[model samples]
Target: MAGLTVAALGVVGFLGYQAAATAPDHPTQARPGSHASQSKEKDKDRGRQKKKSTALPAASGTGERVVYALDDKRVWLVGADGKATRTFEVGPSPASPDPGTYAVTSRNEGGVGSDGVQVEHVVVFHSEGGVVFGFSAAVDGSMPDPNARKRTGAVRESRADGSALWEFAEVGTKVVVIP
Candidate 1:
């Protein structure tokens, strides 16, 4: 009788071990209320806010027409009829020779020995065909020195497709547009 009892206990232990080892890794049943449902609710709230902010009025040409972006980083050519004709990305602003023109300089001083290298100075001629010219200058601000300025010959004619039509070296001061 004692031997039979011992045998029965050993069989029960082996069955428990086998069940644990062969069980699925994940839980068979999910919790009553999971975080997955809560996350979906939060996403819906964010979507509503985004929709409200981008709710622009219909193309009505009768209201006050303006050609500026909300962030002021980009300018749009809006007709008096309240229609946006063209849009251009305008970077930061600085002093310029031409009135209403602006200049923006993008520099990186973090890299090794990058203190002397200036990335690019984009001078945008807003009035004249909305021309945007790019130039690499020194960190000392010697090349595009707004003070002792010379018109770097049209580096290239501004194209609608953002391509350089022509390029001339650092020529004289005045940009002579040859027709």
Candidate 2:
């Protein structure tokens, strides 16, 4: 009878170990009366907040300006209060401009883009070695691929974004480029 009892305990111990080894690393079973639906809703809300958040680094100078993050391929139209009024993604050029503060020197309502696309909202800010750096948007709302051979430094954005930039960044508007 004692031998039988030991054998039964051994069997139970082996089964318990097997069960634990096969279990998932995370919790697989839900607790009774747990708020699973509420947890899912909270997770979705967190995702939306994550999407809305853009952690902007410190920008140079003061007052209203447009901040372009070269590494992130993002742009933020900062207001005079140093708050971002608008933000969007952009297609960077292979020829990166030197990180510094610049002013919009010129504007064109429409032009034939370097990639031969009909573009609008051309805002020129910097020119070096014959490559004029600026922001533009295609008329068809398409972004052009950065052509290393062309030596153009036009940062392409969406049509709507370009329109906003065109209206916001006038001649002499501050543009801060950051690495």
Candidate 3:
């Protein structure tokens, strides 16, 4: 009986030693160069690449003219001296029915109202010396609403010095000048 008890005690002691040995130590704080740190570094690198890829180029020019191009659309702006000052994107007014002529007007009065009323008027303005230089698309359905009469695509404007004024969407489309 004594021998049997000794054997049982030995087995229990071994099990206890194993359980204590395998118990996890107090959770240690993560050290630098750990897996988490490596992952963070990788994320930062990806962010840097994304920013570089999406950066816009600086504009370039020195004359008084400005030319803008977005996709297949283009526009040219010239100063009184025939110098280009600014080029921008613009779409046709809604009153035009031709598909090959681009036109713009200073009057904006027609559009689909929020209440579903078909308000009919031109919207959008490009002014030079108080003169409206409106632009239009040469196709039907190009300008659907007066309130949203700006070009419906990307727009990039550059000054005569090649400095970019703005790069955005639907610019120079809404809001017209009368005189």
TM-score of every model versus the real structure = 0.23, 0.68, 0.21
Give lDDT tens digits, candidate 1, residues 98-156: 32223232222222111232333222222333333332333233333323233331221
RMSD of each: 17.3, 12.4, 18.4
Superposed Cα RMSD, model 3: 18.4
Candidate 3 or 2, higher TM-score: 2
Q: Write down the lDDT of every candidate, Cα atoms only.
A: 0.34, 0.85, 0.36
Count steric clashes of candidate 1.
Answer: 2
Best by TM-score: 2
Q: After TM-score superposition, what is the CA distance of residue 33 in candidate 1 from its true location, in Å?
A: 5.8
Model 3 bad stretches (over 4 Å): 1-71, 90-105, 109-179
Model 1 ranges off by over 4 Å: 1-34, 57-78, 84-179
By TM-score, how accurate is candidate 1?
Answer: 0.23
- Residue 163 of model 1, lDDT score: 20
Candidate 2, residue 24: lDDT: 64
Model 2 regions more than 4 Å off: 1-53
Q: TM-score order of candidates, best first? A: 2, 1, 3
Q: Rank order by lDDT, top first?
A: 2, 3, 1
Model 2: per-residue lDDT, tens digit, 101-156? 99999999999877778999999999999888999998887775666676678799
